[model samples]
Target: MNETIETLLNHRSIRKFTDKKLTDEQIHTIIKAAQQASTSSYMMAYTIIGITDPDKKAALAEVSGHPHVTQNGHLLIFCADLKRPVAQATSEQYEATRANLENSEHFLVAAIDAALAAQNAAIAAESMGLGMCYLGSIRNNLARTDEILELPKHVIPLFGMAIGTPDHQPELKPRLPISAVYAENEYPAYEEDVAAFDQELADYYESRSTNNRKDTWSEQMIRRFAKPMRMDVTELVQKKGFNKR
Candidate 1:
């Protein structure tokens, strides 16, 4: 396999990191790579906030409930931002622009743009011999996170990434089989594949080097969906002037 494919396949979410930090040039390069990611209609509706201050990182860590959020050498919060475009609109176009920006479609577009950029940044960090973990838990308390970041209207933090030198190497987690994930003309039923993958994942979880546990993918999913999760997200997003439609 090619080097790029190998990098992609060997990906792991790194939680433990060393004290070694990323250089300014390295951060710039990684962000430049992120900017190169494709955006819908050339609208790069994303903003990356790099947290450097110890107090701010601590506040964000509290928001995410993850110590790694504060321990990482570099923390980047990726936000879906429509404020810039909205601000750029002419007085005559302000109403129409605000209406479009408030639509759920634009909200999805902004979210997708942020996700794509973040994946690019992840790839770049991995290729550069750095380890990174995505911090989606920031959304667990979106209101507090927004307050910590001092975000304005029309901008929402989607997720964060913690990047630094690796202090631990984790076993690669097994993913769902391609048959379950990929389909041709239409979406195909993959109950059998999912059942098989559940066993595979359970084995991996049991055999992993650290924090070994007996759990199946299906069981995990059940725990995840059995209760309504992050129920306040919709209300918070609407408060930010998104998904009004």
Candidate 2:
């Protein structure tokens, strides 16, 4: 396999980070790599906020309920910022109508842009022998995250990535089998396949999270499906002016 494929296959989220601070040149390189990622329609409707303040990091950690936020050497927030374009259109005397300002397509473009940038940054960080972990929980405190980042309307914080040197190495987590993911032709019916896959997942998690606990993938699925995250996302997005259909 190629080097890029190998880098992707060996990927594991690093939770524990060492005290070493990233050099200014290293930070620039990572951010530049992220900027090099392809943007949808070249809109580039994304913004990155680097948080180094101790107090702010602690507050963000509280919001995320992840202790690593406070402990990590650097926090990189990737935001889907539609407001930047709104400002551009407004400044250029173009119609910054509400409909034009907020649409599912526009939202998707910004999200895709942010995700692509983040992945690029993550890979670049790894190339430098640095540790990194994606923090999707930054969205857990969406309102607070906006306030902390001083984001304007049409700008929503999607996630954060914590980066630094490694204090510990996490084991490679197992993934779903190709049969469970990729289909041969059209999508095959695979509800039955999930049960066995979940068993594998449960075993994997049990081995990883707890000390040899008898946890099954079925239980995890039940726990996850039992409480959804998006049911409340509508109300949250409306607060930022993206009222979905």
Candidate 3:
């Protein structure tokens, strides 16, 4: 396989990082790659906040419910930002209607933009032989995250990414067969395929180096779905001045 495809296929989340830190040039290159990602209608509705201060990182780690947040790496928070555009419009004496500002479409667009940019950065870091982990746990306390980051209205902290040199090597996790993911004219039957893949996942989990547990993907998913998760997200989005529609 080509280098790019190989990098993409060998991707694994890195939890432990070495003492080595990334240089300013490396961080700049990664952010540049992220900025090159395509945005919805070129709105570029995203902002990246890099955290380097130890105290701030520790606070964010506590708020995110992930101790790895304060690990030896560069930590960045990706925010879905509509406030930038609104501020620009206001500067130009352009008034945005309530529908234009608070519609689901705008919220979705900003979220998509932020996700795309973060993925681009992740791929770029991986390509450069750097270890990285995406931290969705940062949203565990969205209100606190906003307050800590001093986020203005119309900006939502989507996720965080930690990047550094690898201190641990993990086995590649198995994925479902193509039969379960790919379909032609109609949606192919996935029940049997999923059942088969569950066995493979259970074996992997039991054999993994860290946090080995006897469980299948389906079992974990069932436990996850047993209760509503992050239900406050709707209200949080509304508080950010979007999703009102």
Identify the candidate with maximal lDDT.
1
Per-model CA lDDT versus the true structure: 0.92, 0.81, 0.88
Model 2 residue runs over 4 Å out of place are: 91-97, 206-211, 228-232, 243-245
Runs in model 1 lying further than 4 Å from the true structure = none
Residue ranges of candidate 3 with Cα displaced over 4 Å: 91-97
Could you tell me the lDDT of residue 91 within candidate 3? 41
Top TM-score prediction, candidate number: 1
Per-residue lDDT of model 2, residues 1-245, tens digit only: 98777778788898888778888898899999999999987888899999988878877898898877877768899988877765756544544356755677777888899999999999998877888999988778677777888887778888999998888878887776777788988886667778778788777766775355766677767888999774655666767866463
TM-score of 3: 0.94
What's model 3's overall lDDT? 0.88
Sorted on lDDT, best first, the list reads 1, 3, 2
Model 1 weakest 10-residue run by lDDT: 84-93
Native-to-model Cα distance after best TM-score fit, residue 38 in candidate 2, in Å:
1.4
Lowest-scoring 10 consecutive residues by lDDT in candidate 2?
Answer: 88-97
For candidate 3, which ten residues in a row score worst on lDDT? 88-97
Residues 1-245 of candidate 1: C-alpha lDDT, one tens digit per residue = 99888889999999999988899999999999999999999889999999999998999998889889988879999999998866877878887787878999999999999999999999999999999999999999998888899999999999999999999998887889998999999997899999999899888988888788999999999998999988888988999999899
